[model samples]
Target chain A: MSETPGIPAPPEEPSEEQASRIGVDSWVAETERHGRGRGPLWQLARLWEYSPDPVKLLAFVALASTVPFWTNEGDLFVFGLFTLLYAALGLGLNVVVGFAGLLDLGYVAFFGIGAYTYAELSSSQYGIHWPAEATIPIAMAAAALVGVVLGFSARRLLGDYLAIVTLFLGQAFVFFTGVANPTVAGKGLTGGANGIPQLDPLTFFGYQLTSTKQLYFFLLIVVTLLATALYFANQSRTGRAWRALREDPLAAEVMSIPVNRLKILAFVFGAAVAGLCGTIYAAIETAAVSTNFSVSVLIIIYAVVILGGFGSIAGVFVGAIVINCTLEFLEPQNDHPEVKRWLFYGTIVLLIALLKPWFRPVLVLAGTIAFGFVVHAIVAATTAASWTSGVPVSGASWLARWAVIPTGSHGNFNNYLYIGLVVAVVCTASLKGWWRMIALVPTLYLTALVWENMLTQNGGITAFILFGAMLIGLMTVRPQGLLGTARVEIV
Target chain B: MTEAEITATEKAAPPAHPLLKLDSVDTYYGQIHILQGLNLEVQSGELVCLLGGNASGKSTTLKTILGIVQPRNGTVQFEGEDVTSRSTSYRIGKGIAIVPENRRLFGPMTVLENLEMGAYLHAGGAKEDFDRVYTLFPLLHERRRQLAGTLSGGEQQMVAMGRALMAKPRLLLMDEPSMGLAPILVERSFEIIKQVHESGVAMLIVEQNANVSLSIADRGYVLSTGRLVLEGPAAELREHEDLRKAYLGR
Candidate 1:
C-alpha cells in the first residue's frame, strides 16, 4: 500500500479478495485517472497522489511555479493560495515531526499564538499598534520563545508522552483565551475573548495590498521565498543532523550530531512557520478570534498533513488545499445538513482505507459532483422553505433557517440522508470487505449530527453523540485514518 | 625500603608502561560487576591475541579501546593518551577503530555506505581513502553496493576490515572475525590479518580459538577471571610446556 499520513499502509497490496470487491476495472480506472502526464492539472492531481521523494520535490516546484498564475476567485486559485499557506506550515512541521520524529498534535497552537501575536500587536485596541510587516517579525519572535519553552521540557519526553504534553499546552492556550475573559493578563496586550480586530494589512515598499486577490498573490510570493529558504536549510549540515536523528537518535549521538541542540533547533524552526502563518492569517482575514484558533482548525491542519503524507513537504501543500477547500465547500453555512457533509467525509475516508490506490481519484471526482449537487439542492430547498414557512423572505433565513426547510412543507432531508448513507455503504463495500464497511457507521453518524448541532443549536446532545461515535470509530477499523499510514519503528 | 632497593626490584620486573593499558578497570551492568579490576597491556608493534573462554572479558577489553565500554574505577590509556573519558567518535578520530564482535555493520546500508561510515571520522577526505580501502579488500569493491547484512560471513568480515581501514586507524581491534566461518574462510581471514600486520597497523585480536590466534600473533596474553595469567612472545608462549598442554592440544 502507498504511504498516507495518519493511515497505516495496507499490510499487503490489494489481494484478489480486495480486487473483486472494489472491482479491478474500477481500480484501474481510478489509477489511470490519478496517473496522467504532468502539466498544471497533473500537478494538482499529484498533490493528492502519494509519490516518492523526488516526485514530491517535483510537485513542490510545480506548485511554486503556479503561485504567479493565481489571479481569480476560481476554485484552483483559492486552492493554490491555501496550498502555499499550508506548505509553509508543513515545512515548519517538517522540522519537529519529520526531522525530529516528535509527534506534535498541538502545533496549530503555535500557529495560533503567532496569529494572535500579530492580531494583538497590530490591532487598534492594543493602543500600541504596529504595521503588519513589523508585527510579522514580532509574532515570529514570540512563537520562537514559546518553542523554546516547549523545547526545554520536550527534550525529556518522546512519543506518546511528548504528544500528551504538547496536547496539554494546546488545551492551555484554548482555556486561557476564555478563562482570562479580557485579552491581556493586565498588560492589556490582547483584546481577550473578543480577540483582536481591525488588524493592519501588508504593504510591499509603498504599495499596500487592499484586495483579497492581491493578498493571495502576496502570500504566494512569501511562500515561494520561504520554501526556497527551507529547501536550502534542509540541505545544510543542520538538516543532515535532523535526518540522522530521525533515523536513529543513539546512532546520531554516537556520530556527534548534538542531539539536544538539533531537537531545539527543529522545534524553533517549526514554530517559526506557525508564526509566519499567523501573520499571514492576520492580514488575509483582518480579524483574530479565539474561535479561529479552535481545535477544529488544528484538526484541519493535521488532516491536510495526514492526507498529504507525513515527512513530505509537497504532500502537505497539496493536502492543505484539498482538505481545507473541501471543508469550506461542505460548510457553506450553518444550515448545511451535517449528515450529507459527514457522509462525504466518511465515503472519502472509506475509499482511501479500502481501495486507496484505486479509490483516491474516484472520490475526488465523486466528491466534486456530489458537492455541487448538494449545494444546488440546499440553495433551492432552503429558498423554497423560507417562502412556505410564512416567515417573510429575509436575509437571515438565507443564512440559518434554510436547513429546517420550514414547518409546513414536506422538505425531505431524510431522502438526501438515505442516499448519502447508501452511497457511503456502496463505496465502502466496493473498496474492500463488508467488515470494514461496518466501520463507517459511527463516522457517518458523527459527521451528520455534529454539523447539525453546530448549524442548528449550541452543540446539543447530538454533538456529544457524534463525538462519542467518532471515538469508537477511531478505536477500530481505520485508527490511522482512511488516508494515513501507520508509523513503523524498529527496536 | 630505600630507593636503591625499589630500583633494583623494578629492574628485575617487566617494564611497567604498556602500549595499550587497562589498570583496575571496573565495569558493571547495573549491579553485576562484569569486569573486576581487570589489568592488561599490549606492547608496541606486537600482534597480541587475547585468549579466553566465554564471558572472560576478552571482548570487553577490545570494547574499552573502542570506547564502547566505560571503565568505572580504572584508567584506559593508549600510547599515553588517556581515553577513558573520550567518546567513541573521538576515539575513532584519534585513530582507533574496531571490527566489532558480531560485525555490527549497518544492516540497511550498502557495503560501501558501511565502509563510508567507518570513514565517518574523516568524512570529507573520503575519495582519497576509498582507493586504499578497496586495495586492501578488492572483493569489497565488487560487492560494494550489496546490503551489508545479506553478505556471507567471510565477505562480511572483509567488509568489516575494509570499513576499519577507511578510518586509517593506528590500532585495529578485531573481535572474533573467525567466529562463524568455514575452516578455509577462517584461514583466509588469518592470512588477511598477517597482510594487515605487514602493512604496519598495530593489531589486538581477540579469539577463543587459542591455537589459531597464537600461531599468527607476535605476542599472546592468556586471560582467566579478568586477570592476565600469561604474557610472552608468540613463539615462546606457543612452546611453553603448560601452554602446549592446555591450549595447543599437543
Candidate 2:
C-alpha cells in the first residue's frame, strides 16, 4: 500500500480501495489547504455540533441570583443556609458515588472533621479564636488529608469492603468527639457532645453575614462554585478517566489510566466538599451536635445520590434540593408524631427494594412533584392562617396534630395547592416539547419562593409530610432524579 | 567499515527486528498450562498467521503477546525491545493494539466511543484518527453513534477493528477475527486483514480457519499442543496435504 503523508492506513479497511484512500502519497498539503481554526467561538461551535444537548445557561443565572439573599432572613434563613451547605456536601459525595462508583458509608466523618476543625480553631471550642476566614481554608486542608487516607484504603479494597471501612471511619469520628475531653488543654477544645456553640459567622470584605437570609445567599454562592468546579472536573480528562474506571477497573487499568490515582482524587475531592459544608454548617447553626453528623445523615445523603443517579452532577443538585426541601416542609399529622419516623425511613427502604428494580424513573419524578406541592401547600396554609388568626401558637397540640395526621388547618389547604402546582410543573417538563422546558421558569420560581417560605419556618409537620411524598414521587417517576434523565450507553 | 555499518550491511537490515518476537514464552491459567514455551516472530509489514487445533494454544499465543497473560519464562519482544515484564497497558502504550476474539466491544458504549477509546491513549489526535477510521468503514461511520452491542456481528467486528486502528499501532495482534461469522463475513474479514497488513503494520494473527489465515499470511506457523509443528510461506502451507487433511476441512 502507498502510505499517506498525514493519514495512516485504517486498521480495518477490508478492501483494496479503502486501503488506497488512507495510504495516500502525502496528506500535509491536503490538511493545510482545509484551513481550520478561526477562533474560540469556532471551537465552541464545533463542540456544540458534537455534543448531545445545548447548554442550559438560564439555570446557571437563576441559581446565581439566590446567593445574594441566602443569609439575610432571621431564623428562617438558617434552613436555607444549611441547605446550601448540605447540597455542597452532596456534590462531593457525588464524585465518590456518581463518578468513581465508590460507596462511602462514613461520609459524615469528613463533615464532622470539618466541624471539629472549625470548632477547635474558632471561639466555639478554643478560647484562642482564629478569624472566620482562616478557618475555611484550614478546615478544607485538614479534611483533604483525611480523604487521602480514605482513598488509600479504597485503592486496596472495593465494593462492600470499602463501604465497611468508611462506616467504621464515621463511627471512629463520632466516638472520638463523644469521649475526648480536652479541658486540661483548653476550655472549649473538644466541647464533648454539646459540640461548639457561639461559633462566629464569616465576614467578607467588611460585609457581615449574620442573618439567615444573608447566610443563605452566601451558601448559595459557595454551593454554586463547588458544583461548577465539579462539573468541569467531570468534563476534563481526569474526570473521563474516573468514569472509565467506574465502568470497568480492569479494562481502565489496561488502558494505562492509573486507576488508583483517579480513585484517590475522587475521594479527596468528595472530602473537601464535605468539609466546606461543615464549615458553613458551624457558622449557620450557631452550634454543632454529634447527632448532626450521625449515621442517619450518611444514609440520607447516600439516598439522595442513589435515588438521583450515579455519575450525574445535575442529578446530585436536583436530588439535594428535592430531598432537603421536603424534609424541611412536611411533618406528620400532630396526633401521632411517632408514626412519622417509621414512615420516613420505611419509604426509603421499600423504594430501594421494590420500586427501584423497575419503573424507577416514573416513580421518582412523580414523588418529587407530589412532595414539592404537598410541602408548599401545607406550609403556606399554616403560615397564612396562623398569621391571620393572631393565634399565639400552642406547642404540644400543634405537634401532635402535625405528627399523627395533619388535620385541616388553613395551612393544610395551602399545602395542597402547592403540591398541585408542583405536579403540574413536573408533568409539563416531562411530557412537553422544548418550548415547555423554556416555559417551566415561572413555575419553578413560584415553587422555589413557596419552598423557601416553608423551609424558613421552624421544623414543621408539613415539611416532613412533603418529604415523604417527594420520596415516593422520586421512587416512582424518575429514580434517576426529579430533573434528571436516564443515561443509556451503546456497546 | 565501522562495526555499526558492517553489521547493518551484513544482515540485510536484520529483517526489521521482527516487529514481534516471542521466545519460549510460557503461560498458565492457575494449574493448567495454556501456552508452553511458545515461540514466534513477524517482521515489519509481514503478515503471519498462527494455525492450530482447538486446544493448540493459538489464542493463548496472541494473548501472551498482548500481555493479557503473564509469560512464566522467556521473553516477548516488540520492535527488538523485551516486554516480558511490562503490563498490558504498557504494551498498549508502546503502540501495540489488539482485536480479541468475539470482539469484546464495551457493550454500553457507541461504536464511535469504542473507536475513540482505541485512541484514548492519543489524547489530542483523536478527531483525525476518527475521520481516518470512518473513511475506511463507511458503514461504521453511518452507525458511529450506534451502540456497539446493538450492531450486527459484522458491524461489531468493524468497531473492534476501528478501535484497534485508533491506537495507530506498528504491530497489530488479532485473535480469531473470523470466529463465528458467516462464510461471507469470513471472506470480508480476510480482505481487511490483508489491507491492514499493507498499511505498514506488522500482523500476528491466530486462527482455527487455516485456509483464510493462509490466504492473507505472508508466512505461517502451525501449532499443536503449544509446539510449532509446521512453518512455511503461505502458498506452501496451503498446499501441505497432511496438514490440510487433519486440521483444515478437505
Candidate 3:
C-alpha cells in the first residue's frame, strides 16, 4: 500500500529528538488539562475570577448585611452568625489548602483550641473568670502557637503525610477535651464530655452582648474585616510566594522561597483565624463542647471551602452561606416539616425540568403522578384501606391518595421502604430513555412514602444527610466551587 | 570512595580548581547501586558532557550534583569546596543552577514568572537577569506573558536554558538537552550551549546523544553501568573505536 505521489509520503517525521520533545510537551499539557472542568459553571467561575475584588466583596457584604434587618432573629442567627463563623473557618482553610496547597484535615482542632481556651478563661467551671477581651486574644495566640508547633513538627512531611498528622491532631484535640480533662481543684478542668458551661457573653467595656442579634452583627463585622484582610494578604508578596510553593514546593525551594518557613506561616495564619472564629462562637452559644469541634465539623468547614472554591475569598463566603442556610432548614427545631417536604418535591421537579426537554417535562410530571396513583390503588385495594394509614405531611391529600401509606406501627417496614426507595432512585438514575421514565414512576411513589413514614420521624438525621449529599454533588459537578477559578494542575 | 580516590583527587586538583567535581561518587536508589566510584569533573569556563546509554546513571549524576539525590560515598566539590552535604536550595544559593530533564518549568506560570523564580536568590537584580535571559533567547522575551505549559518544545528548551542562566550560576548542570529535538534543533541547542560556555559559564551536561554532545563538548566522559569507561579530550573520545563499539553502538 505504497502511497501515490500526492498521498502524503507517510507524514514526514521530525528528528527522533524533536518529535520526542513535542510528544512529551503535548502529552503533559493535554494530561494536565484532562480533568479540567468546563461548561456554564466553569464559565461562570471564570467570569467571577475576573471580577473586581471590591465589587465582589461589597456585593456579598451588602447581601449578608441585609439578612438581620429582614429576617426573624432565629433566622438571622442561623443565616448570619453560624454562616459567618463557617465562612471565617473556610477562609482560614483556603489559606492552607488553596493558597499553600497543604491538606490540613485537623483545622477544626484549632477551632476547638480557640473555643476551649475561651471557655477555660470565661466559664465558671473552674471558677476562672476573665473578660472576653483578654480571653479571646489569649485563645487565638495559644491556638497560633500550637499551630506553629504542629507546623514545625510536620514541616518535613509532605502532602498526604501532613494530612494524616493533622487529622490525628484533630482527633487528639477531641480526646483531650472529651475524655482527658485533668482534675483541677476538685473539678474537671475541661469538664470532660459535658464541657464547661455558664460562659461569659462577649462584653466590651461595661456593655455586654446578651442578644443573638448583637452577636450576629459582631460576627458580621469580624468576618467582613477578616475577609478584607485576607484578600489583601492574598495579594501581597507572601501570597505570591504561597501560590508559587503550592504549584511546586521543590521548585519554590530551589527558587529561594524558604518553602518550609512559608508552610509554617500558612499554618499559623489558618490556626489564628480558626481560633478567632471559635471564641466568638463559644461566647454566643455560652458553651464549648468537644462535639462542636469533631470530624463532622471539619467536614462541614471543608465542604464550605470546597463548595465556594479553593482560593477565592468570595467563594468561601458564598459557600458558607449556602451550606449553613441549607443545614439550618434541615434542623427539626425549625418547626417546619412542610419546608423539607416542599424542598424534596421541588428538587424532584427541578431535576425533571433540568433533565427533560420542554414537552418531556410535562410528560414526566404527568406520568409520575398517574404512576403513583396506580401503585397506591394496587396496595390499598389488595390490602386494607387502613393499610394506607401513615399520614401525608402537610395537607397534600392528593399525595396521600397517590402514595402507599403503611398502616402498621412505626416499624421496620418504613426502613424497608426507605431502602427500597434508595435502590429505586439509583436504578432510575442508571437507566436511559424510556426505561428511566418507567423507573422514575416507582421511585417517585417510594420517595413520598418514605418521606411520610421514615424521613419525617427521622428529622434528626436530615441535616447531616443534606450536607453529605451537597458535598457529593459539589465534588461531582463543579469541584472548583462557584467563586473559585478553575485551575489547571499538573499531576 | 576508597583511600586511593581521596589521595588521587587531593593530588590532582588544579591550582585553579575545577568549577565542579564528583570524585569516586557512589550513589544508590534504595538497594540498587546506580553510580559506583564515579569520578567526573568540569573545569572552570569549560563545557563537559557526561555520555551514557539508558540506565547508565546519567540523570542520577545530575541529581546528585544538585543535591536532589545524595551519593552514599565520595564528595561533590565545587570550586574546591565540598558541597556533598548541602541541600538542593543551599547549592542553588551557592550559584549552582539546573535545567532538569523534561524542562520542569512551572507549567501554569508565565514565562516571565518562571524566569523570576530562577533569579529568586537575587531579587535585587531581577530586571538585569531578565534582560540577560531575553538577550540569550529573544523568543522567550516575545512570549514572556504566555504560560510555560503552552510553549512548544524548542521554546520550552530555550526557557529552561534561560531560566538556568537567570540564576547567574557558577556551574550550570543541564540534563538531556538534546533528548527530544529534531537534529537541526539539537544543533541549535548546542550552539546556544557553546555560546553560554563561550561567555564563561562552566557547564556539565548529561546526554545519551554521544555524537551531538561530543561535537561541542571540550572534554567528554563515557559512563557505563555508573562507572567511567572512557575519558579524554572530546576529539579523542569521539574517535575512540572501543568506546564507539562497546557503548556508543556506532
Candidate 4:
C-alpha cells in the first residue's frame, strides 16, 4: 500500500540483533553520552545492574553463610544473627513502603503481635508449649488478621494520614502489651511490663533450633527463601500491578487495576513477613518483651529499608549488614573503644577523600592537623595547665596534646564544645568555595575534640546521631537509595 | 460520496442505543460544579468528538464516563448497563478504555510494561493482542523496552493509544490527543485516530482543537461552561457560524 504524504514510512524489518536492541538503543545511547569521566564506583554499579538476578542472590548467600565458620558466638549473634533478622524485617517493609508506596509506620506492631502470639503459645508464662511449625503460622495469621483490620480502617487514608494512623496503632500495641495488660482467663495476658519469658526454642518438624549457629543458619535459609519468593512475586502479575498503582493510582484504576485491593494486599503481605521475623526473633531471644518492639526497633528497620534502596531485595541484605554491624560495634558493652576511635577518624578521612581535584582532601587534612596543634598550643600558653592535662580515650594518647580536653570538672564544657561543633558544621554547609574549605579545618578539629570527650563516653547516642547524619547525607546525595534506579519526573 | 453524505446516511439510520450514554450527569469537584447535568453519547462504531475550550467540562465528561469522578445526578450506561455506581476499574473491565490527558503513562515503567498493564484484566490471548498492537504501530514495537517517560511527546502519545487499544475495548475515550503535539504531529495523530476509528471501535475524543477533531469526527458536541451549547453532525457543526468563529477560527 502507498504511504500517506508527510507520515514517515516504517523502517525495514529488523534483523535479530537489531530487534534485540529495540528498547536498549536509547539507554545505551544515554550511557554512552554520559559514560565519560565516570569513576570506578559508577562502573561497579553498572556491572552490578547488568549481572543476572540468581547469580547475585547466590553470591550473597554464599558470602553470608560463611560467617558462622569464622566468627565466635558473641560476634555471630550480635552481628550475623541480628543482620538476618533485620534483613527479613526490611524485606517486609520494602513491600509496603517500597513496592506499594505506602508509608506504613505502624509495621513494627505486627512484629510485636507475632512475638506475643508465639510467646503465649510456647512460653512458660502461658504454660502452653506448641511446636515452632504450628506457632509460626498461627503467629503470622494473627498478625495478618490485625493487618486486615488496620488496612481496612486506614484504607481511605494516603501518605502522612496513613502513616499517622498506623503510628497510633503501633503505639496502641505497645501500650496494650506493656501498660494496659488486660486479663485473659484470669492471667495478665501480656504480663504487664515484664513480657512473657522462657519461651521454647524453634522446633520444626523434628529438629530444634537451639544454638546461635543453628538459629543463624535457619534464619539464613528462611531469608533466602523469602527473597527468592519475593523476587518471583515482584516479577509476577501482582508485582506489576503494585508498581502500576505506585506510579499513579488514578491511572492504574482507569487501566483496570483494583488499587485499593492491591494496597491492602501489600499491607497484609508486609505484616505476615514481619510476624514471621518476630516469631524467629522471640524464639532466639527466648523472650517476648514490649520493649523489644519499641519505636527504636522500628527506626532501625526503616534505616535498613531506606539504606538498601526501596523495592530492591538484595539492597535489604546490604543495608541490614551495614547498619546492624555498625550499631552492634558501637555498643558500650562491646568494649571496642579503640576500634570506635579509629572508625571515627577513618570515616572523616573517607569523606574528605570524596572531594574533587585530589588536592582539596590533602589541603583539608593538613590544615586540620595544623589548626588542632595551634589551638592546643594557644590554650596551653594562655590557660592553666589542668586544661590540657586530660588524656585521650584510647590508643590515640599521643594526640592528647592536640585536641583540648580539660582535666578538672568544667561545668558543661563538653556540652559547649559539642554545640560549637554542630554550629561549625551548619556554618560550613552554608558557606561556599574557599570560605567553606577554610571553615572545614576548624570543623574537623572540633569533631575530633568532641569525639575524644563527650561522644566517646556516650557511644550509644553517638551511634544514632551518626546514623541520622548518614541518612540525611544519603537523602541529599541519592534519594533513589543505593540500588534503586534514578527516576525522571516528566512534569 | 462526500464526507457530508456519509455522515447524513449514518444519522438517517440511528442505532438501537448508544454504546456509551451519559444522561444529564451532574459532576462536582468539591464545591465547584464541573459537569452540570451533561448528556453525551457515542453510537456503535461511531467517531464522536466532544469539543470545547478550557474549563468547558470536556475532560470532566470523559472522567464521568470512566467513573473516575462520580456524578451527583443522572446515570452512565455502557452497552445499556448502568455503570454510574461502579468503580473506575469495573468500568474499565466492562470494555471501556481511556487515553487520559497528558498521556499519563507510568513514567518509570517500560513501554511494553505499560501496554501489559492495559491488558491487566485480560488473562489469555496476550500474545495475539500484543501482535495486533505491534502491527498497528511498528515504532512502538521498536521502542517497546524503553521507559515510557523517556520517549518523545509524539512517541508517548503513540504508547498511550497503543496501551488503550491493548485492552480491546469496544469504546475508546481519548482526552486531548492533540494538546501537546506539534502541528505536523497533530495532523499525523488525527490520521491514526481515523485509522483506529475505521477498525470498528467507537470513540469519544475530547479535544480543545475543533478543526482537527471535526475533520474526522462523524458528529461533534460543543460544550461551554459545563453545558452543551451545540450538537449535530460534524459537517454541519464545522459550518455553524458560532462554532466556526469560536473554535474553527473562521
Compare the candidates by DockQ and give the number of the best one. 4
TM-score (C-alpha, index-matched) for candidate 1 = 0.65
Consecutive 10-residue window with the lowest summed lDDT within model 1 chain A:
A1-10
In candidate 4, list every pair of residues with a backbone clash.
none
What would the per-residue lDDT of candidate 3 be over residues B1-250, giving only the tens digit for each residue?
A: 3446546755884778778889899999999999999998888888899988899999889889888889999999988889999888788888889887877777766787778777766762367788888888888887887778777778889988888888899888889998778889889989999988888898889998888888898888888899998887788888889878865687
Task: Go through the candidates in order and give each one's DockQ.
Answer: 0.10, 0.15, 0.25, 0.58
Off by over 4 Å in 1: A1-80, A145-161, A164-186, A233-238, A287-303, A332-491, B1-19, B42-70, B98-125, B136-166, B172-250
Best by TM-score: 4
Give per-residue CA lDDT, model 3, range A1-491, as digits (tens). 12222222233333533422322345654654453454454445445544578767766666666777778887777767888889889989999998899999999999999999999888777677888889889999999999999999999899899999999999999999999998988888788999988899887775799887788878878888988988898876678678778887876776666788999999999999999988998998899999889998998898898888888888898889878877876666776677778877887787666543457768878887888778878878897667776567674777678777766674677768766765676666567778877777777777667667766666567447535654664465456777675564432
Mark the regions of model 3 whose C-alpha exceeds 4 Å error after superposition: A1-49, A338-391, A395-398, A401-413, A420-453, A479-491, B1-15, B29-32, B138-146, B150-155, B178-200, B246-248
Q: Give the TM-score of candidate 4.
A: 0.91
For candidate 2, lDDT tens digit of each residue in A122-212? Answer: 6635465676688888898899899998889668688899999999999988877776745656464557777778876666655667866
Q: How many residue pairs clash in each candidate?
A: 14, 82, 4, 0
- Which candidate order results from sorting by DockQ in descending order? 4, 3, 2, 1
What candidate 2 gets wrong by more than 4 Å, as runs, is A1-57, A60-79, A180-192, A205-207, A332-491, B1-16, B51-63, B106-113, B140-151, B179-183, B221-247
CA shift at B142, candidate 3, in angstroms?
Answer: 4.8
Candidate 4, A1-491: lDDT as tens digits: 12222223333333523332445546655665454334654455555665678767876777777889888999899999999999999999999988899999899999999999999998787689899999999999999999999999888898899999999989999999999999998899998899988999999887888999999999999999999989998998889889888888888888888788899999999999999999999998998999888899999999998888888898898899889988887676776678788887998898787675568889999999999999999999999998999988775666988888888788888878877876777677667778878998998998899888867777677667756665765655568777776775655
lDDT of each: 0.65, 0.68, 0.80, 0.86
